[model samples]
Target: MIEVRDLTKRYGAERAVDRISFTVAPGEVLGFLGPNGAGKSTTMKVITGYLPPTEGTVLVDGLDVRRDALEIRRRIGYLPEHTPLYPDMPVSEYLAFVAAMRGIDASARASRTEAVVTRCGLADVLPKRIETLSKGYRQRVGLAQALIHDPEILVLDEPTTGLDPNQIVEIRELIRAIGREKTVILSTHILPEVQASCDRVLIIHRGRIVADGTPDDLQSRFSGLRRLSFGVRGPADRVAEVLSARTDLRIADVSDLDGETLFQLESDADTDARPLLFRLAVEEGWELTELHRDRANLEDVFRSLTSA
Candidate 1:
């Protein structure tokens, strides 16, 4: 539902977001990842119409973000890192105010406010002033304000920041539920958050698009080596010797314990040595007790692509 082409944002001589391009399909949840000063928030700002790009174009449902700024805003709900909130207003009152700002009519305001309150779990704190609530409640209030408009797209920058573990899981589940019906672009420092909440991963570094794909896709693409751990009831030297006959893999570590030997093998990413080892055990009268493979995960891919 969104498209960005060669988008760049600059402040004086430094480019916060270098020319980068990507698209988000309708009902897709995209995770925007980056290290400090990697332009993740800058890109979100440009997409949400909070900041204009220095070059290139952003289209929301085919409408140009520059020329149709107001229309695009109408379609997007934004929760910035530092939430814009009124400390004095009660949660219920605050939500109503934001609903009105989104152009909800007076007759519909109460119902709209009630829906967001229920969805955001603000019932108990409805009468409490925003300043009196805990940081987690404050975040809920911020999210309530964002959803009060019921926009088709949600742009959340570090939505789980400052939230406790339970709150983080709650927000992650909430985002996933929302993504089922609307497009979402989530930016956060937490890698597991991206894994649990986003369908696709997009990594930015040094103001450039470093990686973009489904989690599994990126992991497979960047997984340079595959390592396997094996346990067999046999002599360690003989086991290593038998396994070393293959030129595709090298046994990195071996040790014997309780009449069983453990072997660590490293091979090319595309190679799978399990079948060979299983057949070898059968033919050589060796009892195989355990076999495991260590695969590269999202963090590894992120580090490989974005780390210096």
Candidate 2:
């Protein structure tokens, strides 16, 4: 539903977004990840028609963002990092005003306002002024304003920035539910938020996109090697002797606790040891208590991609 090709944005001599490219399909939620000053917000601004790219093109549902800004705006709901709100307006009144700005007719304003208020859980705050609401309620009001038009695509930047744990969970669940039928591009520094809410992720660094894939795929690609841990009830020397026969696996660490021995193995070679380990334990009369493989996670991937 969205495509960006070699998009670049510059301020004076510095390039904020350096020729980055990616795509988002319908019903897909893509997480945009980067550290501070990594051009995440710059890219979002270019895509949402808030700023024009210095080079390349951004397309929403096949409409060029630069050439068809109005049409693209009609289809996209943008919630910037700093949500612009009328502090003096009541929640319902503020949403109604935004709906009207989005071109809702006078007759349909009330229903449209009600729908977004319900969806964003702002019903309780309807009568309260935005300035009087809590941080969570204020965030909800921001989201309600964004969805007042029911846009096909949602571009949310740090949608849960200042909320409590409960409010964060609520917003995450709400975004996940909305993503079931629409395209979403979510930008955040919170890695776990991506794992919990996004179907895929794009990692940006130094003004360019460095990695793009599902979280599991990026983890596997960066892990490169596998590590395994095992615990057995046996003499440490005997356990070492038994494992020493397998030249394919590298014995990384070994320790003993009471009568039980723990083995840590690292191998670049792809070897399945379930059958061999089980049979060897049985033949040696050792009680094999635990065996497991450890793989890289999103944190590892992020560090590998972003570190200089």
Measured with C-alpha atoms, the lDDT of residue 217 in candidate 2 is: 80
lDDT against the true structure, each candidate: 0.87, 0.85
- 180 in model 1: Cα distance from truth in Å? 0.8
CA lDDT of 99 in candidate 1? 85
Task: Kindly list the per-residue Cα lDDT of model 2 for residues 37-99, writing each as its tens digit.
Answer: 899999999889999989998998899987999999989889999666789998877777778
Where does the lowest 10-residue lDDT sum fall in candidate 1? 292-301
For model 1, the superposed segments whose C-alpha errors exceed 4 Å read: 226-267, 273-296
Error of 1 at 272 (Å): 4.0
Query: Which candidate achieves the best lDDT against the true structure?
Result: 1
